[model samples]
Target: MHTSVSLKALALLVFCCLSTFAGAAGKCERLVATGNPEYPPYLWRDPQSPKHLIGANADLLTLIGEELGVKIEILYTGPWSRAQDEVRTGRVDLLAGAFLTLPRLEYMDYVHPAFFVTPSVVWVNKDKVFPYSGWEDLRERTGGTLVNNSFGQQFDSYAKANLNLEEVPSLTQAFQKLLLGRTDYVLYERYPGVALANTLGMLDSLETLEPPISSEGLYLTLGHNSACNDAWLRGQLAKKMTELTAAGLPETLLQRNLERWKVQQSQVVAPPPTQDDSQ
Candidate 1:
């Protein structure tokens, strides 16, 4: 009887030790995030710190890390598509800014109550402007946008069936194509497009038509395979995001970054106009 009792105690001790180890191992101390490095006023590669990302989304993530007592490092992983791939494969813990879509839900969990709403606009050269009152007006025209970029489910599906859009590797190339008359327009977010155009000295030559193609929420998503992903962290993130959005913090950050981008642009020389694609 004494042997059995001692064996029981030993089993209990082993169980407790294992549980403690697991709890310790599961505890998260830091999170690595990534996003669209070319995106401005939302996220962009920090010129001064090329390996890191900066702007509104980065600022928001920093605030979230402080609240969660976890260090959040927003890295410029690569282009936006590569960044998404990193998050999908668990190489990164979070996407600092991502638009919701059915396929993305398979690999990441979007925190409820998105922190920001972004408008996707149709950009055309000022001299090449057309009468664009709605998405239907864009049919038959050649549109260019970055690879793997989405406006929303509805527009994405519609565009696939009705529009002729080209996928480019970078916004710089897309804008260049539009400016050089290679494409009729470029579909991109208003603020980032404006920021990039201003930086490239092309703002004077471009214009956006109303109304916007889509206005979608920009979410902070945790990778499904991330070691740090757990009920506690998810709950805390949702809670914090709700409170911050209610407080209207995102708009403030965006405005600040807009000016910040302009200041940074002022320090650099703008890219020269591209030659016509045919030439």
Candidate 2:
């Protein structure tokens, strides 16, 4: 009887150990991306539905999550400055999409290669066509930009030293200033500007100046301090992103987002037409 009781206790211990191991193996925890509340077509909060984030970058991240078999969450922390702070302090695991920079490299590891290329375009009022071919062409014009937006390390330096750039709190305000003739021109990512313009029904009011100022590819950045900082994980993500790009994922995602945007736009009820007195 004593021997049997000892064996039963041992078996119970073994079972508990196995149960704990299985629970850990099934754990679905992983680092996710976070960023500012603006930056449309790349990242942005929906005007009509603030909780729903809509854009190309968001779609791309969703695909990445699906490929990795993990859940991707978006944590909005305010502007780019604060969001970068979160990643730096390990408060967040990733910054969904970012331009590769030497300074950023110090605190984070970028997934190998970039998934999408974005051009920095100058937008101006349609009535006043500015012949801006590049940064040099914009020397004489006053530019408006988001407060924490970095065009690139080099461009940021040059703009700080030479250009007359007014830093605004948000891109929408920057575009609004441009439309109100408050600023000479607004410089931002081409796709984001186009997406915002289309959404605001102001696409016809603004035009992208010929020849982009500069272009940069965007990458997913992983915080160096995060538990998900394993080289194998990075390698897997890089490989998946490359495969998606090869499969023409960016274009496909853009088309889907555009269609969704159209649906959302159509859902907006128009004001009832006034009865004409002459009729």
Candidate 3:
């Protein structure tokens, strides 16, 4: 009789716990976002697994999803261009991270209080020196940069008018051109440049110049035509993101993930220890 009563109590407890969890999770079932899989120390595709993306931005998004009672999946859909296309078409609900662009505004609504900001820096080969103080300094040099990568509204306008840059397929390609002396410099984010350079074993060969070409906020936005776009969801996310920013969550995550990447990358480079043969 005692065993029967205990079993009934346990079942009732499980039912109540499940009901509470469902009530919380009902706010948002899931949110999908994708962008620039090459970007690191912010976002990037895990080398060990192509389908999963890992980095600072991914960590922060996970926290945001938890706060919203939703599952935020950062998928490696394709190249940066394809991800942007998906977001624009509303086939994907969100752009994982992006800068504010006039064109993007037409198809997506940016959430309030951007999660982070990053600078577009110029990286040059160590032996090839260019004293860069501003964008005008780049006007004379033939640089390489990824296609569809934007620095900012003002910088983009100026670069289009005055800068001579060869648009490559990806950051790695652009950096390769710079390394091979095909391009004078490469335009990319500072952290990603450092991360990629380290990954490529080119850390000793490259240097990032100051000042940055332009610094822009990295944001999450909902596609305008998304069937799941809800005003309440947008407002809730905005509030939560702002609170997260105030708590310095994104910055903290970036540092932690940066260290994690270092460890992971080192493990990749090192060979496994051989079994002892002394016995």
Candidate 4:
């Protein structure tokens, strides 16, 4: 009777464990995600479907969902700031792409082995190009970038301490300022900046200097407050990300999306929205 009772207890414990695992997995059946809506190639508001975001990051999240048997929806929650807020409050479960930072770490858990490394460069109007070889070259010059944007923690700290950068609400505004000669240069990621310049019809006017300011890894983050923030979901995401990165899938997706953005841009003759338009 003693042995039988012990066996029964073991069975009950196993059953409880399975039940807990299933419960946790069930809560993650559908995840809502958001990110910087204007970040082309990586992420952007689908011109055809403005309510949804479509880009390489969105494609990656969709593949992750397929592998994990969870449905992930990347939405255009609002601007970059509002998207971060949505993730912070658990209104959204995922950040499609984000840079690692101390403040952001407070509200999100970064997946290990960042999926992509992005290079941020100094963009200047072609007619006003300067001899920028390093960070020190911009010590006294004024630069501009989208508000809440970060190149990397090291660069962010350095810029705060030693650089003069004006913050603007949108990339459109930042580039506009650069073109108008209001700012010496605008710091932004390479491919996305290229894509945006192409869309804004400003590609001929802009050029990026060599020796990029910072090369930072972009990560997919799970909100700290998300109901789906369980060990199972986190482990699965990290595992799939590691597999996909190893397979070199992100690069293929980025190139494909670059062409996709160009095709979409060609279809629309009217200019894209601006900072004032968003406000």
Candidate 5:
């Protein structure tokens, strides 16, 4: 009887130890993802709540955290260039949404099957005219784009070589220049342009050229040096993405959040302008 009890106690101890190790392994406290705080309708700071970030990508990340049983802490890093640097140097565990580029592959591994597609399009003022069939058609026209934004590395290169392209700080400024007749065309992402135009009440003034220049898939990229770099983590993330896609979680969530943003924008009461005595 004592022998059986001893064996039972030994088995219980072994199971307890294994359980403790498994729990420790699964204890994921915080997940860090880098993003530009200025990019609107995708990843941006909430105007009313500056400390809180909001956008489609931010909502998607929150959903992902819930589905994966992990806590996500967003680090509002500036600009795509700096965000990439953070991901590359292991300062951030992942980049929330990033286009797959050759240079990026050196520092991170992309999750299989991108989560979203962004179509690049050219926006032109309704008053100024141009017959644009493609990038080639814009050779004679002046183009504008964000300073560090890449429609595509190849397309950017072509624009540099073939057109008189001006780099600006933000797409909002690019559109301003376009409206003021400073540039003939501005290239930007179609969805974002739509949201931004609506926000600035410039939808009627600017139009997106049909037939997008190119569409790129955006993925959640894991840092090469992260603890979650193993195949198991990759598989887990892939499974989570598949489940989310199957449930149409990405689209539904994005639509709902976008509608909220639209309502918020509409409710914003612009302050009445004061009369200028100098004028």
Candidate 6:
């Protein structure tokens, strides 16, 4: 009886120790995040290094990492279209900038409230003015936008069904088409669109419509399949996101980065216009 009791006590102690170790194990000590490299003021490839990402999202994530006591590496693994795939496959732990969509939820979880809210706007050459108040205004006019870009599910559906829109490989192509008067209008986020226009030195030629077409929140989302996607980590991220939102950190980050982006654009040489590919 004494032997049996001693063995039982030993087993219980071992189980307790194991549980403590698991609870204390640094499973989420570090994280990797990535996103579209072309999105300025939010995320973009480091001008010096294509492998690393930089911008407001990177700045905000660094702050988050400090708050959470974790090391977060934001990288630009590839093209924007493939960024989601990298996260979905668990090669990337988080998408530093993402929109919450039903399709995306299947692969990852959104950490709310969003880190930023950006408005998708219509951009037209100063010479190609058109009467535009809403999405319906574009039904009769042809528009160009970046492929794989989503304003929102509703707008995405509407554009597919009613709008005459062409998808190009990059926003650079879309802007080039607009500059050349090949497309009636261009659709893209307001800040990035303006940043692109400034970088291209076409701010005088292009103008964004007031009352944006659609506004979407940009979030820090964790891939469900990521090795670091633990409940504890997710919970902490959600809490931190909420705190950041309440503290207006997102808005501050956006505003600060907007100026930073403009400064960066001014210092760098813009790429030459690309061939029109709005088919």
Candidate RMSDs in order? 4.2, 7.8, 9.9, 3.0, 6.3, 3.4
Residue 168, candidate 3: alpha-carbon lDDT: 64
Candidate 2 residues 1-279, lDDT tens each?
999999999999999999887554433356667765656556776655554455777788877877777677775656666678778888888888888777888998888678778788889999888666578877867889876677777787788788999987666778889989989999888877786677678899998887877788888888887766666567767888888889898878777776775666578734223222221
C-alpha lDDT score of every prediction, in listed order: 0.89, 0.75, 0.82, 0.90, 0.75, 0.82
lDDT by residue (95-178, candidate 6, tens digit) is: 998877777889999998887888989999999888888888888888998766778777888888998888877777788898
What value does the lDDT take at residue 89 in candidate 4?
98
Q: TM per model?
A: 0.88, 0.78, 0.83, 0.90, 0.79, 0.87
Q: By TM-score, how accurate is candidate 2?
A: 0.78
What does candidate 3's lDDT look like per residue over 1-279, in tens digits? 999999999999999999877654444588888888778888887766667678888888778888877788888776677778888887788887889988788899999798988988889999998777888899878988876778878888888899898986567678788889999999888888888788888989999899998899999888987766777778877888899999999999889888887888888854222212121
Write one digit per residue (lDDT tens) for candidate 5, span 1-279.
999999999999999999887665454557888675545567766666554457877787777777777877766665556667778888888888877776678889988677778898989999886787787888878888865566666776786688888876566678999999999989888877887787778999988887788898878788998765666556767778777777777777678777877777788844123222221
Q: After superposition, how far is residue 212 of candidate 5 from its true place, in Å?
A: 0.6
Best by lDDT: 4
Give stretches of model 4 more than 4 Å off. Answer: 1-18, 24-26, 269-279
Which has the higher lDDT value, candidate number 1 or candidate number 5? 1
Specify the poorest-scoring 10-residue window by lDDT in model 2: 270-279
Query: For model 5, how many clashes?
Result: 0
- Model 2 segments beyond 4 Å from truth? 1-28, 46-49, 269-279
> Candidate 3: lDDT over CA atoms?
0.82
lDDT-best of 2 and 4: 4
* Residue 110 displacement in candidate 1 (angstroms): 0.5
| Residue 55 Cα positional deviation in candidate 1, in Å, after optimal superposition | 0.6
What are the per-residue Cα lDDT tens digits for candidate 1 across 185-226? 999999898888877779999999999999999999999999
